[model samples]
Target: MTTELSVILAGGGTAGHVSPLLAIGDALRAAAPGVEITALGTADGLEARLVPAAGYRLETINKVPFPRRPNAAMFSFPFKFKAAIDQAKAILTEAKADAVVGVGGYVCTPVYLAANKLGIPVFIHEANARAGLANKLGARKAAGIGVAYASSGLAGARVVGMPMRKSIAAMDTAALRPAARAALGLDEHTPVLVVTGGSSGAASINRAVSASLPAIAEAGVQVLHITGAGKGITDASGALLAGAGYRQVEYVDGMQNAYAAADLIVARSGAGTVCELAVAGVPSVLVPLPIGNGEQKLNAADLVGAGGAVLIDDAGFTPEYFATEVLPLLANAPALAAMSAAARAQGRNDAAEAMAAMVLEGTKQQSTGRHPKMGS
Candidate 1:
């Protein structure tokens, strides 16, 4: 009888990490019905909720952040990191993990170390154009490395694309457009622009949209502005400042609906957002977050290069830019259609399955008395 493949999916703290982890877990379960899947995450991270909510058994360890500078935390780092690795070892031993797959997060470093020490195969997937620190460290000894962007600097990493939810991967925007608009209470014929700054909201984006709302409405374009939590534009009466052809919400539960209803998207270009826009074939105006190691800007490159997206610097994405650029783009039907096609051309919905195959392949090799090289 063939032994059941057991795997541990590690990485969390943010949706960027947890989302891919869940997608990989789902793919593994689909590929091998009897596979045992357990998730490793930090107690306080988004994974605490999302992992269980996705119907996987979750194991948590203390978060160990690598200090960038010499400080008190740096002095105590070795001990804390070891403890986290110990916790990972305990979890992996108990689950009898045949292989470990990590997306990228604070939890990944220790999980990689533990899996390595146990002589189990490790698979890594980096979701950004520039790899994160944990993933950078883990990539050195990963049995199979996958990246969502070609520019991701992890050596020997394959460009397998971003693993996303089925709702996004299988979305048929054109077919679902009318029903999606009706569900969102939007008119079927009006050009719809969806603006978001992600879950925490973007103050500059909100400000620019608020200032440009009048012009947008005048152009027969309707707006669904997803202001990040607590960032809603309001009048003195404390009510949201929404008028005809404008809607403001702090969040949207299902992004697929927004993608389906949108003629165009105006948003920050996180890796997930950029990939989703491509997969959904939505034309976009991307204003990358002005912080970090320029990963957001790098994330937008391929889509922009393909002519599916327009890239605007954060400082230049003001009300004037919105009126001069976005308004005219929304009015150009042929251009929007071409942009949609270009974006679709870059979509890869098979990433989850591809990553899952790597895990299964590693397990098969292990079972057959052949082992993947420790640093291959």
Candidate 2:
């Protein structure tokens, strides 16, 4: 007899956490049409906007907990964590969830505890090469940990590549370009440089790009810049292109088109974005955000070491250096091609399917009260 499955997919705060959630959700839906899936996230994170958009019920929790950092939020954690867990536990009971999948967001704190308390299995997926604090904590109890990198620290962890979005995964280099370029109004003769500061935008990267706009434009290249929502950067006044042909968008809704249109990419080296770039195989200059645990730098270092990308120290990311580093490669097609091949080699196109299989097997095991196959 076939068993039906229900799940609590939990994570948020950033695109890194939320994109994979949707990827896996799509996979699960495709694999098991009758499977019931519910998402748990704070109202504050991108998940608030994305989960429902993906056609799943996203239950809200207390504000996500910040880590060991000292602050008034930290001080109130004891109370908030308790309330969050209670709320999450109630949701799990209502969903009749067989397992809780944690994807490394502060919103996961309560979900982790609630799942364990109810004897529900926890399945965690860590996309970063290094485990985030939340995933590390949750991994200890999870029935299995799915990982994007071989080095991720989760017991029984399978080295599953990060799940990519359906839109991105469907793209083929040859066909994707023409369609994407036409939609963006870019001509084939114009070399395209895709610049982004992630979903939120980077002040430094934007400033540097703006400063070097003239030089970049002189390279006979057109720029597509996603300045982010709050950055308040715009080309409406026509300042960004200023004769240096360009398009400035506050946020990118269709990322596949952007990836397809660009000959080269310049952006932050967040683990999720890096995963996409690697799979897309676009030559890039990785500018890692320097802060927190240096995780972003570590993510960029992986690409640097793999010969897929070049890492630019944030401190040395001046407009002059940007022009110097890119001019040679931009002018040299062979170097760019090699980088693209290398980046593409690093992407595992099957990761999303692989992760969905794992979760499905995990749910089956829990339902049967028996050990599942190792691969499952």
Candidate 3:
């Protein structure tokens, strides 16, 4: 008899966490056609919208962040954590979950602790080189650890390169350009640069790109800019060349088209985004986010160190530099091709399939009464 396979996938608050969770869930669904999947997230996070939209059931937990100030966090931390843990356990139970997989976020913490308490196996996927706080807490504590970067702090971690959307695995780069360009109303002769600030938009990157549109356009390169929600546009279109169109979007539901349209890309170096770029064989100029956890830097480092990308610090992301850097690269055909080749060589598109299979294998082993715990 085939054992029922069900999972409670807990992770999400921001796009950073939610995107990868969806990718993994999508992969899991494709691999196990009969598997049951449910997502756990907070009521207010981006996940509340993204989860159900992706066609998975989403259960909300009551969670609040612990502030750095002892005086402030001390007053409310315990109650918040307890409520979240209780909610997570309820969701896990209701989902009839065989395993709880934490994709990383405050959402992961409660599911992890609850799974630990219930004797339910907890597994975590850490997508960055520098692990997030929640994933770090669950790293050794969980039964299994999967990482996108080999240098991740988890002691028994297996390097499973970050999973991208299913669309990316089969995307044909050779036929991508002309098709994407035609779809976007772009010319076949001009080179294209795709810049995205993620799903929420990047004010700095946008401002810098606007300042350089004229120069970049004059150099025979077009721009496809994906500015997330609430990104107010300026009157920079008049500055662009007639042949070089600047397509600005609030969000891109079809990201495969964006990757397919461009010769090179400029974006924040988050693990999920970088993995997609590598898998698509798209060359990129990675500008790491100057924020908590140094995750963007770590993600970019994984590619740049492998000769798969060009790393740019956020501080030096000036308009002139972008124009100068991008123009020369686009003008040089062989270099662009080489970068694309390197990006493809560094990617593992089969990672999700491999990870899902491995997880199923380990879970089956545990069912036989032999526990598998990672050594920290």
* Candidate 3 worst ten-residue window by lDDT: 367-376
- What lDDT score goes with residue 154 in model 3? 79
Cα lDDT of candidate 3 equals 0.79
The models' CA-based lDDT, in order, is 0.90, 0.82, 0.79
Error of 2 at 119 (Å): 1.1
For candidate 2, which ten residues in a row score worst on lDDT? 367-376
Error of 3 at 192 (Å): 0.6
Candidate 2 CA-lDDT value: 0.82
The alpha-carbon lDDT assigned to residue 304 of candidate 2 equals: 76
Two-way lDDT contest, 1 vs 2, winner: 1
Question: How many times do residue backbones clash in model 1?
Answer: 1
Clash-forming residue pairs, model 1: 201-228
Question: Which tens-of-lDDT digit does each residue in 1-376 have in candidate 1?
Answer: 3566778999998777888899999999999997889999999988898899889999999998999888899989999999999999999988888889999889999999999999988999999999998899889988899899989999998999999889889999999999999988899999999999987788989999898877877887899999986788997798889876889999877789999999999999989899999999999999999998999999999999999999999999889999999989988999999999999999999899999998888678764433322221
Name the runs in model 3 displaced over 4 angstroms.
71-73, 236-244, 367-376
Backbone collisions counted per model: 1, 0, 0
